[model samples]
Target: MQGAVGELRTLSEGDVAAAWALEAAGYPPEEAASLAKLQYRQREAGELFLGHFVDDQLIGFVCGTRSLEDHLTEESMDVHEPTGTTICIHSVCVDGGLYQKVLQNSSKTNSDRTHSSKWALCETEGCGDPVDGQ
Candidate 1:
């Protein structure tokens, strides 16, 4: 059967099963998050978690936290000051058949190796269209 178009949504407690299912399908068994961690992130403030669903079933996710730590700065800070947002894509996976399509559509262009977390923002703003499948 042909897979349906994927939809994006903020992950919620109700989606634990679907999320775990996707994790099982996408990664090795040892890597999947326990249900408790999933629930905690959903309730945590300033945490951003997004999932891709096909016909109401979770198929992929991009979860991250905003931190004040500068990835490029090695110097220790005396006092922590929140700076620009850091969006870490914990994972991005799709069914085997759709891997190429997902990669083509989801990758970010002009990605700075110094700041990997900015890719999510770049992809969202369409800043790097070269990698996106038009």
Candidate 2:
């Protein structure tokens, strides 16, 4: 894990290339959002897009939207209200070789926090794995 941390800032037009690269490395073309769509989301405040880079190269990303709904689906796309209800961890992807590193980093970041109210949701083999603890 030899890398520097970049600020997890809001997405911007300048980040489209990096974002597209991250998505291409993780998902199929049809499943990933276009750079324009991502930029639009950032402009509209419709989603939270965070990027993780190493040596100025994008290697991972986490994106989600705040919503009152518990889980996200296609239907949820129509609802853009930000209620701060749930910080849904919609998409989290790391370069194929860096999954473990990303997971460890995430666990470390959340480990110190008490497990009383947080619900962590992750996907494994296309199944939602919800864990309620630190």
Tell me each candidate's RMSD, in Å, in order: 8.7, 4.4
TM-score (C-alpha, index-matched) for candidate 1: 0.56
Candidate 2 lDDT over 1-134, as tens digits, reads 36556433345567667777776668777666667656655555433555566666667766554445555434333344455344445456777467666555554443342122233354532433334434
Q: Provide the clash count, candidate 1.
A: 0
Give all candidates' CA lDDT scores.
0.47, 0.53
Highest lDDT scorer: 2
Q: What is candidate 2's TM-score against the reference?
A: 0.63
Q: Give the count of colliding residue pairs in each prediction.
A: 0, 0
Candidate 1, 68-105: lDDT as tens digits: 54331212111222343434334455654565554444
Alpha-carbon TM-score of each model against the true structure: 0.56, 0.63
Model 2: lDDT of residue 93 = 70
